[model samples]
Target: MSVLKPKIMMLIGCLMTSSAMATEVEPYNKANAQQLKQSIYERTATATSAIERYQLAKSEAWLSYADHEYSEGGFTSAGKEAYIQANQLLEPSNVNLVTQIISPSQVMRRDLWWQIEYLKQRGALDVEPQALANAEVMLVWAAAEYCELGWRHAREHFISAERELQKVIYALPEEKPFLNWSETETPELSALNGKGCHGVNPDLWPLKPKTPVEPEVIDADVANVVVENVVHFAVDRAVLNTEGKRVLEQIANILAEYPDMNITLKGYTDIRASVAYNIALSQRRIDSVRDYLLEKGVNSSRITAEAKGKLEPQDDQKIEMAHAKSRRVVVYFNDAETNSITVQPQWRDLQIER
Candidate 1:
């Protein structure tokens, strides 16, 4: 049997959340495009060196792309972000473009923005404008997605931003700034340089490196495969604990990676209270999990939830400590019923948090 790609044949079509039907950008398209065009011409008229002319051309290209994305639906933020890149790359002589024209209070993507800015001040743009341009666009798009949509949509762009920026950083030498020519280059020690917001908190870092759930593909020809993960909650509590949150985050990551796989969150409660109350509690638990997944950018249309209180308990009744085992939300990743094998996550832990 030929091995198929990890495409979820049964899952919903992965759609861009913020890019399509971005009609709001229509009102500002002409004005924004004109602003960038004027800036480009201003630099073009003064561009005497071959390098300056090249940069100006790139700036114009980005402006054109911005116009195209703006005219298209569901790309309002992208158009704006591209527009920003066009202005930034121009870097007019003696013009404090970043410090004066752009707002220092930009809070999103600050660290990456700072490093990229530092590189621009050195010579990243002159050396490899396309690489630098891709990085800048990705960085701004990442932040814009986070601000407009959420982390689920933003994580992809953030990853791309880092990767593209690394290409530029690796290709270019660590040159000294024109003014601070004697200073050393240390990216790890760099600060936000009076930018309004403090860097992203480590505790709340979205998609920080973690052991990802590797689903095992049992067969190659069975397309009706379902991947499953479980999020265990505390006794009777609907709120998710730290461990539960981590489990759900991993689930969200899977959904992010597999757009075609629809998720079914089935909540189960231990055999303790009345079936009705337990059912309600189980629903609440699933609600908590579903809400977290939604906030992480999982489309609500792709999610289904069920409450199974005490009926389908995972059998924690034998041991005193096993009762908490039944209070869980089994996350099922369903694919289109075809002819592929099933995939399952390797996770089983009773999560208890006070």
Candidate 2:
């Protein structure tokens, strides 16, 4: 056999005799194992460009051995060490790949613990194991939930991001309160570094949406549909002063302008006397206006006379003037069959109760 062949054989023989290393190897002892270990070492060395490359190649061999141990149904402590060593060799340069692999799983999805563990594995953190792991975990969770928004509810992502960012900001060292990051780094991993977790886009979360204004509804069919305020009051007391007459004239003009418009004359009074007395007073007030309008040439059917006793008022006019606001007539134009009345009374001659 060649000189190198004998050395390879001797090294493999020694490796196989770990349980009894002091005992001299016989010629036939673990001949296959001796050949395999030597071949593994030789192939690793051949793949290398330099010592560093050799180290990486050795790491791969260690990984293969660990895989073999796992496949054999029992892993030794030494096998775990080999696996860890292999991972360490690959971690720093392969962060993005590792993140991609672990990010999608439910347990590791944007989870801080998993992120911290990953960073620790890559030797990015030098703190106590627990602290480093916990801190990274929070940042990972925040980035996953808030950055680009993965497969989770928006609200849940927002809440989780808030909590995680708060922890990361507060726990960071005073001198290095910000995380080290770069654009070319793992996009998902780098996205977690502090900025506005929720500030990706503002127009997306609009402060206020544009709204359309509705046009004011006016019934052209009603002749007395005056935009100006009109008020009415009890009989004898229902007499319109100069200002009241001006308002009344506006109503009349509105009716004249729209020939098809009809009017409903409603009268009301406060609870001054008995209900019956108030009811009569309201009817009288409405009649007085109807007579005046009739004399003014308005058709009797065009105006519907109705009375409301001591119920509706314009103002709580306890004195004569304020009472005048309460005791008044209201003209509803478009309410012919079905329409909601939205106009408020600004003028009236109705009784105001204390």
Candidate 3:
């Protein structure tokens, strides 16, 4: 059995999925022939060095061959081989321009993986519907690319692809009228989507843009994911207990190992108090946690503390324990998914003051 190339197959699938009326050449078209040809000339001419110029020339030659092949009929075997060779020699900059300005008009062959790159150039942020759809196309193609590359960095690309796809999904009701795509497609797309790519929280994707920095290393096989400890205070009291100081020490040691990791100290409280009072109490707890961490030499910017009273309880069962758990602050490593976690033996038995 013959295996169809992913790009060619995907294009065919897309065509099959859409109505022929919807397949009109205008809405999907990026640029016209004159514009495309002009871009080719401009890019080729504007190339700064001999190397860049040669690469652009090679890309233009391939575009010419592709146009001829599509419009004027088949090429000779030798001519086809020459076209392939010229394409292989093209640089990434030239390749990007060719795809961005020309690929929409060309016949997508087995080697067609250019459309996704074009869409990546227009990420999902504040883009039009067609552009966002094009980004989704890029995302699907990115999955195929990652499958082909099979590296750790491929995880980043795969996640980015999903993010773009998600934006398209979120905007669908606003974009197309009376059109609802099946949620079943989510499983297929979600398979390759890696966690922690959707920004700081998993719930928000594409909208929240957080840099995925590598966690810092501290001791042997230990990395600091959070630079400070999350401490709980009694009501409005900001005093630190022995156990609280011990937790801070643990956080400090981890920070010493990995001085670059950022920390988020979140405070919570029991539901016994009024909403406003609890909110203020939570805020105070967070501030206290922040101050403690800052005193331990952690940068102020690296530490962000927030208080949410009774809103985020640890568990509903055992109300007292849950309330106690709620009245405490917890530290989170910004990039915990990619980092190794270490638990100091003594820090496991923490008993924060009520």
Candidate 4:
């Protein structure tokens, strides 16, 4: 069977063109190209050592290949050959540039996997376990892309990424930063794992599934209690400020009074960023609130947190005030008459006594 069917190759061609079009513009194209060219030449001229020269050469090779691919409107055999030549110049010392500038989509070949292993063997990525893990995840994604294209080496890339991820997981400490492994559900992961890649080892996975916590029923009298406080967050942050903590304290006190009443924290964000980023940020905001409440003696089961992301904006206007109003966490008790309270424009505009 062909690695990539004609239709799949056509779709990839469309995507590559679209990506270039999205970033290119009439006024900037010529200037950007000239600037890149100048930078490359300057870097090459300033190279004082063999390593520096090799790095510069590799960069030039990649840039040349990228230009060709963009101009030609798709990946070509010449581009792949240039990439392979560039790969020979890569060493552990160049890992920083490789990680920062090279993306999986740009180097979707066995050579990419070779470079990854070369860096690992040299212990250059020892301090960057998290980054290595992320690269592995991207490799898995790239493998899936290759599989769709019907590339013969798709399974090889998947197995390589899986092994690299496993190594990183083994070296990591018990406590680590949040790594979204939800992409493991991709058909590629399942397909590759079924072939004995073992990419879905839960023991090494950082994020274990949490048991669903149900909200408690609110008492008839407690249902009359007003629940309209909006907890604010700093721009692009999930850490609660002094004012946010104070607001949560008030909510905690109320929850203390009504033991049977449950509170739902719905998080939101302004639409300034991508949908995926905003959604993640919104979830982090509510998680910050839920954690603070838990610390203040609020029952975990009685509080439920949900992320509405940019979907539920209090005001649709793109002004600063509207943006501030949109980036908030709204509190609602399970049975409280909460619908009447109007969402204020900003944290400062709230009627709450500071």
In lDDT terms, which candidate is top? Answer: 1
Candidate 1 residues lying further than 4 Å off, grouped into runs, are 1-228, 337-349, 352-354
Global Cα lDDT for candidate 2 = 0.43
The whole-model C-alpha lDDT of candidate 4 against the native structure comes to 0.50
lDDT (Cα, 0-100) at 139 in candidate 3: 35
- Local accuracy of candidate 3 as per-residue lDDT tens digits, 67-186: 544454544332343234334434352221122212112111111232222222223222323334333333333433334444463465445444434333323222221122233322
Clashing residue pair totals per candidate (backbone < 3 A): 16, 24, 3, 5
> For residue 214, what is the lDDT in candidate 1?
34
lDDT of each candidate versus the true structure: 0.56, 0.43, 0.44, 0.50
The TM-score between candidate 1 and the true structure equals 0.34
Ranking by TM-score: 1, 4, 3, 2
CA lDDT for candidate 3 = 0.44
Give the runs in model 3 whose Cα sits over 4 Å from its true position: 1-230, 336-338, 342-354
How well does candidate 4 score on lDDT at residue 228?
Answer: 34
**Candidate 4 global TM-score:** 0.33
Model 1 per-residue lDDT tens digits across residues 1-354 = 121123421111222112221223323468767976887788678876534654576567557656776777755645665566566556543122121111211235545655655555444645555656556545545555565567897798787766556545534433222222222332222242233322232222221121123347557565453444666767768777665677677767767877787878888887789989999999998898889999999999999988888887553223433465677788876776312425443223354322
What is candidate 2's lDDT per residue for 1-354, written digit by digit as tens?
A: 001133322321121111221223222223533443455455445643222332344345445544654665765443454444444433223212111111211222333333332333232222222233223323333343433355463345334433333333323222122234332333242243224332222111111111123245567675332254456544337565554566566666666766677888888775577788888888887886777667666778788877888885444212544455567767677534214223445432222222
Candidate with best TM-score = 1
